[model samples]
Target chain A: MEQTAQSKSRYGMVIDLDRCTGCGVCMVACAVENNVAPAEQKATERTGVTWLRVYPVSNGEGFPANDTVFIPMTCQQCGNHTPCVSVCPQNAVEVDPSTGIVGQIPQRCLGCRYCMTACPYHARYFDWWDPQWPEGTEVLLNPDVAPRMRGVAEKCNFCHGRLHAARTKAAAAGRKEIAAGDYVPACVESCPSRAIVFGDLADETNEVSRLSHSINTFQFLPKLGTAPKIFYHSAKEWVRKMADRAPLA
Target chain B: MRCKGLILMLSGVLASLAIGWFAFPAALYRTEAQPMQFNHAVHTGEQNGMTCDMCHEFTENGSFKGIPTIAKCTECHSAAIGSTESEKVLVEQFVTPHKEIPWKVYSRQPDNAYFPHAAHVKRAEIKCEECHGPHGSSSTLPVYQVNRISGYSRDIWGRNISGLPSHPWEGMKMDRCVRCHAERHRDDSCLDCHK
Candidate 1:
């Protein structure tokens, strides 16, 4: 068999939405960590950019129970045949072979926001305005990553920077591979509810892969053939219903 | 022989002047700005000699640092009687309205990069001026230039992309960061810089 990049990395996430409380901590942490710019107070859905969005799925209201569920959405990092990957004219995005990360190259992105439309989950966001932090807050800007200039598309990268860091650490330690705990996304770390779990999907022994096998688990929009690395688990049938399209009649 | 010596002396002077013009930038790198000037020299006085940390503090986890808030400034300047005309205008425009001074940042790290100023400054004893240039010496004011697109000053990108600083630091960029970590044999993880 010919060696390829796919053999090296198969990154993915397994989220237990049932454990999620809709606190938006994951979203907030992702925003700050990834350097996602802010939206004006008055900005509407059309203008706001949220790479990791918490979407509300309501079991239509009734007196007995007005129930709702929150799904934290990010790039699916689909396998060989990625929908958004094909349409990118500039090759601004790529599925890294070693890490299985669906990398978004912001510098190369033209800001057409085409990927945003191509994705069913709406994981990508377009920069609508120049980057702004509260005055004097620029000092807090992360030092390791290039803050995206305005007019670029950004999405949840599964915190690839962390993965890169882990690899570097492992290399320094004279290790051949990143230890399991060596890499975790900011969202996973900051989740107050501990709802998100990130790991190498390729490692069947890894917790992410093991948790994915649970009977309660399902990938959001699996029918679309995106083969999203993220897996959501919930005991509730209602929550499962929200993740997938309506079953064929 | 005297005539030749005169030419040589003049040439030496011209050469030194040329060297100063070209090399001075490397010795003292400064960036131009876009907004009205605001400098510590003019603002600092006997009243409130607040340190830089008063405005910029590290987060509890030591993963993040931030600029001072308008509230921090108001602590002293609210009742402060400016000694200069520009100071008077700053009080009126920024302090009175409770608005922040839109001073462009001098040092901005890449978004994925995480620099713990507290760890480096408080723990490592790095001087503030080592990276920020001598704000204490400037008597006039600091002009804040906004990047036309990113709304940041060009200084934040760096003095020049190619002009790496002489010491362990340059305008904070990934190259400088990796090199420092490499020199120390420290673990330079993307996660360390990236969120």
Candidate 2:
């Protein structure tokens, strides 16, 4: 592999808050695709590995509450700099050059869980037990990846496996780059509402990049310099206001 | 008189070299004879046609399968493979009573090292043999031993300085990671190697 340093992969996402119903399809798909172990069934705080979490925001009306909004959360893969990437001791986490994908290598990780603490979104998770599957469920295991072990830490890899698989197929066919249609993160593929868009930001023709500059588009904590690749889009003024910090009273 | 002195000098050097060779290996070799001689080659061999994933299963969620339970063993051994002495033991200890074998793991990561086999195997298209050698070639039963102090296998730290296992049985260690990382121009920050 000729090492291409920052080959303008321009990884980015656009979440259409207008269409989101807070259904949580992205969360379920993320867990299943990434092999996030079930920790607790009752409260999300306990069991499930919700990679793309949905947050409910109130419209701030009193008893006759006007409206509510759903915001799906995930590793923003902040560009320019990410807090978790800098705080990580083992370099287990990285922002890959080709895909702008954030990579987490489990074998290289020591489960210190520092990255988890650094993120305000709480995207990272720690493995509490050795992964177990219900009997007869072994056949359902994905043959492409390693199951995580107990006493380790884990988080989203942005479905980098799928991207690599796509790239590999492209390369095998004597192509130098991945087709836009050939790759998508599991959440993006499984979203029922079509609220999520994945694409290369550097490609001016890309839909995601175009929507990123839309009047409704916004990034979380942009002032912090995280440069999150995931962008939220909403037509509601209050919802868009909530996407960034609230104006000082 | 000079000849005698030379002979004494040569003898002293030879004695020191011998001590260094034996003492170093003796101190380093943490192999404790395992309770069983489980040969991966026989189990994974084509004659048996055993797939590595059969025992090391992974879930769609990307979690790796662990040591099978007694029921998993009874899935096949319930009928019994009385062809050899090892088979007899397998039947008696695990099959008859439905007891799980206390197989020692030789390739466990540290408490902090997060290794998910599914990501590499299913998503990365890595083969089992890439990390574990040809386990199907051995006919003997496997034995797992741990370091008494660290409660881990010696291979976790790697014996050879070069990071390549001097023997196929040698497990992956931190040294192996550092060596590979250095070659690939990957991260080697303490954070990268430690966690």
Candidate 3:
């Protein structure tokens, strides 16, 4: 379905870099929630599919002076001039106008990797091998999220299976909108430090919206004008500067 | 000789059309009988007056229960209510054995497609007959035909080999869904329906 109308709710996130411990709990939660199979024996860092990845950046100081900051990155969910959506020849990448969330349809993907290359954040991952789970572990996979087959590109869609469930619950209760706490992503819920603040950025009263506009909150590669919904907040000058620069480098 | 050649070419074209329309569908679909024949008319008849939702209900969380289990059937058919052979078989084979009936769903979609029955039935007030035709009024369950290659029901592709719908309720293809959603002016994204 083509969503031509402007969305009322723009779902976004504000991640506090200072609070993130880089424990990789969010990554584990994301994998389990989305039914992302564990990496095959032959898969490497480059080949493995990780919806969320943590990178530790250093202060570039000697010994005791050196400090590290962990940055958790996923799909930025570009609002304007979305690079992946434009480059997808199969029309697999889409920006959901209702919730303002970017979605990837793996069934429609032709494994072209055009969307992967178009994404400046390197968020999209191509499936190098067929999905495999440890024996007796297949039954533990989340039934809501369908396991994607090989030869397709996949990435974070903010735990859309949970969103679907939330919507279903709302519909059952004779409501149109889902409750605020009904649709939290796996990463945000699993965060021990509560570093991630997620909500409708369009809603002025929302904490995520407030944090997005707050001082020191920045988006990666803002100059490119992709208008990413995911925002990063940090008090340090170098951390903010590093976020403003190309995230890949 | 030119006239003979033209006739021969026309014959070839006609043969191809006949094979494409008639023979292809037969070769493509494999028909299998349902485990048991269910008479919906009897259940929804004047005596019983049971509605579709009475059996095929939505859970409290709004997930659709596509088919009722043996428990639901046993509530009525604990011991053959009628002298029908099907009822006797249901009691002895399934209900008595406490085994779930292996019912083949006709409107079963792929895992990627997320169809919310609650949104359609409860919110929009769309009758079950809108998509399922008159299954509630049916005297007997129809044979389930599955495509050999795609493993999808023949109902999804519709009865027509040309991909044309003979009835308004025919075919549950993406285009059919899009057409309905477009008519309703309900704008949706890929994630809304496809998980």
Candidate 4:
């Protein structure tokens, strides 16, 4: 009954890279769900406020050996020592204790980009300008999430807005525990191939939690000891190698 | 000759003082009279004996009602109550037309701020007068002053150049809030208040 906002569940994702077809549906769904505005000018990978980015990774070998794996990248929601949470001069970025989801408060952020620089995955993206939704498309923007203002770093927080709604509904319903189906991130829901799996990794019985312990599953930059919550599964060895690359400073 | 030099120096000093105290603040804040003058004392005083919550009641969902609609005033003053000019103006100008009173709230927070009144007023049980001073007992209305640079009320920074509030609840700056939160051992995370 006293679970306020500070619960201790390791809410995370287990994505199957083999199922992902580089269609970029997750990126589009994330943008709409979060009300991520369009760039005034043409946007490059470095510039746009894309919370979930899909990068097509390839092997160096030519012809028959050449194969691609589209890796959907997001904030790994590191547990052990969150780099962004520590480097933030203002306590804007935080690992929410209850859900264990890394949350960012844009209102507190000073746009110093210290968190962005500290993040090895390059998951954090700075809002260069105020988010400007295309004409009349604002109705399409999800009312659950707040549209972020300019001059702050933003990344995937596993759709905290949805989590909030679920919590509220649970409280109103007089249920102490939130049902797992009530909370799902936009990217996970939007995937046509069911590539993404999201659930409470803390709950040993949960499907995502069990799948995270699979032999094929691997996490990015495990050696740095960030202990990122998000895991990836792939049958291909090249895809696993690409994912397990040494942490880039 | 000494007297002449002293007079020149004294005039220069006085001119600088006037510019510093008057001209600078005047330039910073643009003063504007309110559309309607509200006498809080008449409603809150012993005669009518209306509480602040009577007019500024919270919604069922706990959202602050802020300035009440003209319909709330018209509930009592459907016709002119007494022969008071202000009451007549209230009926003719607003109640008759059914136009809402555009009250420029003194303690209005910035867009980024997320001070939920329900948490403070309902849960914490802090009196409105604690933050708002004796505004309910006052007959006179304060002139609204908007800062040119930050677009905030002069009341937000308090009426001092040093930003030190005369009263405990005078300033609405972040420091003042943090200091109080620290004293109470409340959650002072930026997200706690800044949303």
> Residue A162 lDDT in model 1?
69
The parts of candidate 4 lying over 4 Å away from their true place are A1-11, A14-29, A32-35, A58-70, A85-112, A129-131, A134-152, A157-216, A233-241, A246-249, B1-22, B45-62, B70-80, B83-86
Candidate-wise lDDT, in order: 0.69, 0.69, 0.90, 0.81
DockQ of each: 0.06, 0.06, 0.53, 0.11
TM-score, each model?
0.57, 0.61, 0.96, 0.75
Evaluate residue A121 in candidate 1 and report its C-alpha lDDT on the 0 to 100 scale. Answer: 72
lDDT tens digits, residues A115-178, model 2?
Answer: 8888876777777666767767767764444567766667776676566555445544445566
| lDDT tens readout by residue for model 4, A4-43 | 3334588999999989998989999998887789875766
Model 1 over residues B1-195: C-alpha lDDT tens digits?
999999999999999987776775444444555345556654455555667775676544343346576787688778646576666766778888999777656675444344656545654466887667676447665544444555444455554534555443345555666675666555333434443
Look at candidate 4 and tell me the lDDT of residue A224: 82
Candidate 2 residue lDDT tens string, B1-195:
999999999999999988777765456446667544466676667767778778766554435666666677687778766577667777887779877777766677764454545444554455766566555466663444456566777556445534466775465866655664466564333322222
RMSD per candidate (Å) reads: 11.8, 8.8, 2.3, 5.1
The numbered model that scores best in DockQ is 3
State model 2's lDDT: 0.69
Candidate 4 clashing pairs, residues 3+ apart or interchain: A6-A98, A7-A97, A7-A98, A8-A98
Instruction: Look at candidate 1 and tell me the lDDT of residue A69.
Output: 84
The TM-score-based order of candidates, best leading, equals: 3, 4, 2, 1
Lowest summed-lDDT stretch of 10 residues in model 2 chain B? Answer: B186-195
Best TM-score goes to which candidate? 3
| Model 1, global lDDT | 0.69
Candidate 2: list runs displaced more than 4 Å.
A1-6, A41-48, A62-64, A246-249, B1-195
lDDT of 4 at A108: 76
Q: Write the per-residue lDDT of candidate 3 for residues A104-163, one digit (tens) a residue.
A: 999999999999889988898988999999999988988788889999999999999999
